[model samples]
Target: MVQQTDLAIAPRTAMGRAVKHLRQQGIIPANIYGHGQPSVAVQVDALAFDRLRRAKNTRNFLTLRMPDGPNQTALVRHVQSDAISGQTLHIDFFRVDLQERLAVKIPLKVTGESYAVKNLDGVLLHLLDALEVECKAEEMVEYIDVDISSLNEMDDIIHAKDIKLPANYTLATDPEEPVIKVSPPRAAALPEEEVQVAAPEAGTPEQTPIAGE
Candidate 1:
């Protein structure tokens, strides 16, 4: 639900050393392509891109203000990172139509401690972390919350259709997907049995000594 201001970018950023120079200046070199339009290389301010990432609508459409032509509204389709520095080195922007639906992946955040872990002495296990959804680009969500307070048994499972998602969004993952499960604590180790001791040799040292003598 967060909003970001228009991002300013340069129109013509060429290949090879020129793009490397862009990265050297704390500016991330990127490309915007989609809606069947030709791809164009661009340079976005690193500081500004960081702000947009923290704005809670990172995967959604953003208003990109190019240098020359009309400002294009784009969906942040792909982002490439520098392997060593972990910086945003490249990005792909997709031109979007506001009314059109886009399939995107949404994160699932689990909340609340189960009584199965407290009163019943059990452990909580979460199976699924993120799920895919189909919705309007503008309706995309940052994350979904799944509450586990209602779980009380060892076999309790939280299903996709059970937890609530954004009304504007539709779950693309199967409804039977298990998000979380509660199980009883591990069983105590069993006591080891005493092993039987073997009898000594029938012949004694005295017999060997007498025979040698």
Candidate 2:
């Protein structure tokens, strides 16, 4: 079984504009609800949640330790951030059941060098960065490793059906969708040459006979 990361949070009483004060104090306001229960308001240390997000992200299940209740397994459902600074403002966690299956998009992790990219200088394009998969909470994964070493030509592609999944997990995305591909290297643009036009030779005005002639 994959080890789950632990996140500790405290029950929150602040609501409305008062929640802004929590953020100023390095506390992020959050809500936790799932399994058909009313959402509970909570708060977590900004620094701690940041570390946890960096380590486990939203794909893996988190062991949530609540102040007034039992620890629960949850998945990060939504994260609201400061548009400019990218600071985390709030979060939403959904409680999960270990024995039940759930669908989530697991990030794709590329591994190994592709012969097309290494030898032919082909560009590698990731058509899908994540895979929609269904699995139990205990079987949730942080990311799926994709091997690109099999790409031997510029047009070579990898499809959803080509990737192997964990024993309990199944792909929810279409099997024929292209996951990754190698494209021919882009051609460099040629520098434009400066063209100088010779000044028009000094010319004398042509004289015409008077119109009444």
Give the per-residue lDDT of model 2 (tens digit) for 1-213: 456778899999999999999999999999998899999999999999998778765556788898778998888899999999999999999988888998888889999899989988899998999999899877777678999999998789999999989898889999999999998876622355789998756885767899999
Q: How far in Å is the alpha carbon of 30 misplaced in model 1?
A: 1.1
Task: Kindly report the root-mean-square deviation of model 2 from the true structure over all alpha carbons.
Answer: 4.9
TM-score of each: 0.76, 0.82
| Candidate 1 global CA lDDT score | 0.79
Clashes of 2: 0
Measured by lDDT, the strongest candidate is 2
Global lDDT of each candidate = 0.79, 0.88
Model 1 C-alpha RMSD vs. true structure (Å) is 4.6
TM-score winner among the candidates?
2
Question: Tens-digit lDDT track for model 1 on 1-213?
Answer: 424347888865468877777777888878888778888888888888988888755665578997678888887888899799788888888887767888877788878888887888777887888888888766666678898988987779998888888777788889999888887666622356789998777875433455656
